[model samples]
Target: MNKFLFKVSFIILFLFLGTAKTFAQKLKFLIPDAGIVQHAGSIGYFSVGAGYEIFKNKKGYLDFNYGYVPAFKGGELHAVTVKLAYKPFEIKLSDWAKLYPFNPGFFLSYTFQEDLAYKFHSSEYPRGYYYWSPALRPHLSFSNEIELSIPESWDGLGINKIGLYTEFNTNDFYIVNYLQNTSSLSLSDIFQLGIGVRLKF
Candidate 1:
């Protein structure tokens, strides 16, 4: 009876170990692949975010960001953004460096402000009272970034690469204004510039 019990316990222990390993693998898949921080670019004065390369070959990324604008700078704006980007081309500079010449993306931002009111229901206003919501902005962007691959010696730091990027962005409201007042509003007036860093793990 003792020998039979020992065999059964060993089998159960082996099954538990297998299940735990599978769970760990799934959890690892959910971990973010990169982190980003940026300044300016229409979302806010500054933002911090995390992202994952959702596609193979690093072709696409989905990021979530929180942004802030100080009262002195804007009006103490707070926003959350979800951005999806596509990068289709890469130039390999060396074994340790690569350049992505074009990355085009779109983002949706939701703003939070105490003094401003956003009407969600049509009953709050007559037809076409306001064409757009002040609290929600949809933006289009184009950006380029360079990646510097880290050596394996730095693996302990958990960072595999570092990237520097610059972005130009414009929102739907800006585009509409530009279209309506093309003679007065220059293309430059509708666009904003942003710079940031990305760390890949």
Candidate 2:
């Protein structure tokens, strides 16, 4: 199953890259931006993905990510996620540093190799036994980001901007459970921490 998932991911990535390349010449600015991520809200140990900034000033963005979970951490899982985010404001702190004080986003993820029974009900079970599919997870997050613009001297390296970000995230299922048991569940109990970096070209 792991091998099958790897192959599917590879094929999807290949097709996306090919399509992006074909349209890049006509839509240079619309080409996807690539990045790597680590430890994102317990969704996976790590992930790599691409995103596109929308509008002339890039106030909105959309991303797609592929993540991996090791066998020891719930027996090998592959997650594919689609996210949309909006940056409300940007502050120029200095010549080198700029800050996006708030970025709120939502994501939907599908996990492959997950237990099918958890996602779907058996025929023997009555209707509405489970309200949500385990394979499909929805999350909401808010992030704070600081970006550094590279100087001309570093232009040779082909890197333009570096961003450091941290996010607080929670899933819909967790939130639902927390709401039902508000007296027992604290806000912190439903949230998770994610940290990562982004390099922009």
Candidate 3:
């Protein structure tokens, strides 16, 4: 099942990239402004996706992602994520570089699974036994990003800029768990670290 899902993700990415240029020329809005990849966020062990700035000033982004976790690391899992991010401020370092001090985002992740919410709410468990849905997770993140100018030689590919970012994130479930068991769980226990790169076009 994991293999099949992996193949499907690859196929979808291939198709999206294959049609990107032609679509960009005819329907500019249909093309994504950037491609993104992240490692070790709450979404999964690894994720790859595309995104576009939601605002003309490049302060916000709306992204769609596909993520996977291997069996050895955890249970083999597949997830799809949609994220909205906003950067309220930035500093210019030079003509070719800029820094965003505080980038905050909210994301929803849906994992492929049976409906655990129904089971939790049924006779097997008491009412309100589980307040959160296992299949869908909501997460919050704070990130810092550095943007760099791409070389002019790569213009034909439509590539425009490159960004490297560091992220700290926590999900609703983790936060609640930590709040309930503060002694057993440290503040760091609820937080996750992720690093990613973005290629802007």
- The candidate that achieves the highest lDDT relative to the unseen native structure: 1
In candidate 1 the C-alpha lDDT for residue 59 amounts to 84
lDDT, candidate 2, 12-68, per-residue tens? 999999999888777876667646475766567787777777777888878888888
Compute the lDDT for candidate 1.
0.90
Better of 1 and 2 by TM-score: 1
Candidates 1 and 3, the one with greater TM-score = 1
Candidate 2 backbone collisions, by pair: none
- Write model 1 residue lDDT over 44-95, tens digit each, in one string: 7999999889776878899888999999995899989999999999999999
* Highest TM-score scorer: 1
- C-alpha lDDT of all candidate models, in order: 0.90, 0.82, 0.88
The Cα error of candidate 2 at residue 182, in Å, is 0.8
**What's model 1's TM-score?**
0.85
**What's the TM-score of each model vs. the native?**
0.85, 0.81, 0.81
